[model samples]
Target: MPVDEAGAKAKGGRKRLIAIAVVAVGMLAGAGGVYWYTQRGSADHAGEKQAEAAAAEGEAEGGEGHGAADADPTASYIEVAPMMVNLRGGGAQAKFVKVRFIVVAAEGKTDAVKGRIPVILDALQPFLRELRPEDLNGSAAVFRIKEEMIRRSTAALGKGMVRDILIQDLIQQ
Candidate 1:
């Protein structure tokens, strides 16, 4: 009878320990879930609030009265004339490249860009003339060329006058 009682006490102690461990695991899991929810949920809520505010403001300002162009006043595009330049291939290999691109300018600034096209071309000609056939071999070269043109165009036309250079056609021979 005494041995039976001791066995019961040991069994009860094991059950209590198991229960405590389960409770501890549950609490840790709950805490982790709450932390994850708070971190991820806040960004989504912020975006939703911004969108709602914009919609409310637009409604208040008579959204239908404003045209699409007026709603977001960004630059428009104007195509520049195609340019053909002789690339300096090593020795007498004689290579030529043709490129055509559009210039992004603020609304009503197309005419100014059009009038200054010659200056833009003059600024770009030197860079194009210096390119070797191998220099424009891959996509990386094309990206570098676009960046250079953007830098040159912005420099020639003053900051903000030219927004970007969009390549329309590029041919190498």
Candidate 2:
């Protein structure tokens, strides 16, 4: 009876070992699948970028005579004149801010966009003056400032006129 009991115990231990091995294999297979899926996505993204670059190169080589079609509609940019404003919230001493930017406009709207610079400045001045030093501390802050500038410019120049705002310079003293 004791010999039979020991044999049963050995069989149960073997079964447990087999179960653990199977679970480990399953986990490894799942990890491998996830890794393969992510790598596949990255490969696809790289392929797409390569395709785009190839298309751009082909256009450059083949579209030399088609000047109108070759022109990028989003290439027009209107430079905003430099602006200086006194910043608020710096105790008794006044902190000043200087900023210069470019407004990206639809092609052929350079003159109209340039004419609206004063209005854009008017919209921007108040916001610039109100900014505290802490508000412009990082990339996120700069992005927020650009977005605000775009919104203000769009409001002043009407929707779809200004595509983006490029901050040329920003200084605080």
Candidate 3:
């Protein structure tokens, strides 16, 4: 009877070992599938980028492209002097952010926008001073800041004067 019991125990152990091996194989297969899926996605993304680059190159060579006809060849930019403003909510140690930007003007509106630089700065100064350190956290923050600046510039210079604001430098200290 003892011999029979020992044989049964050996069979049970063997079954457990088999189950563990099957589970390990399944986990490895799942990992491999995930890796393959991620690699395939990146490859697809790379292909898309390459196609875009080719399209851009074709446009550069005078191919009929989307929005190329409407693009202005004489677009002008007005550079803003760097300004540093203290950030809000900086407890004891004063925090400041410095930014230099360029204002994109509408077609034939470069001088108009340049003339309103002081007004634009006046509109932007208070807005910049009110910004907290936390407000400049990520890329989204930068986009928000740009949009706000555009809005302010538009309000200051009237409609169709400011097209965009290109942030040349942003430093926080």
The C-alpha stretches of model 3 lying farther than 4 A from their native spots are 1-71
Enumerate residue pairs that collide in model 3.
none
lDDT (C-alpha, whole model) for all candidates: 0.72, 0.70, 0.75
Model 2: how far is 43 from its true place, Å?
Answer: 44
**Tens-digit lDDT track for model 1 on 1-173?**
99999999999999999999999999999999989977785665455445544543443243545223334456577778899999986655466888877776766787888889898999999999999866765445555676799899888988867766666556665
Worst 10 residues of 1 by lDDT: 59-68
- Error of model 2, residue 66, in angstroms: 28
Clashing pairs in 1: none
What is the TM-score of candidate 3? 0.59
User: In angstroms, what RMSD does candidate 1 have relative to the true structure?
Assistant: 18.0
Candidate 3 Cα deviation (angstroms), residue 7: 80
Greater-lDDT candidate between 1 and 3: 3
User: Alpha-carbon error at 56 in model 3, in Å?
Assistant: 21
| lDDT for each residue of candidate 2 in 63-161, tens digit (9 for 90 to 100) | 334223235655577777899888777466576767777777766777888888888889898889888865755435555676788788888889867
Q: Report model 1's TM-score to 2 decimal places.
A: 0.55
Give TM-scores for every candidate, taking all chains together and pairing residue i with residue i: 0.55, 0.56, 0.59
Clashing pairs in 2: none
By TM-score, the candidates rank as: 3, 2, 1
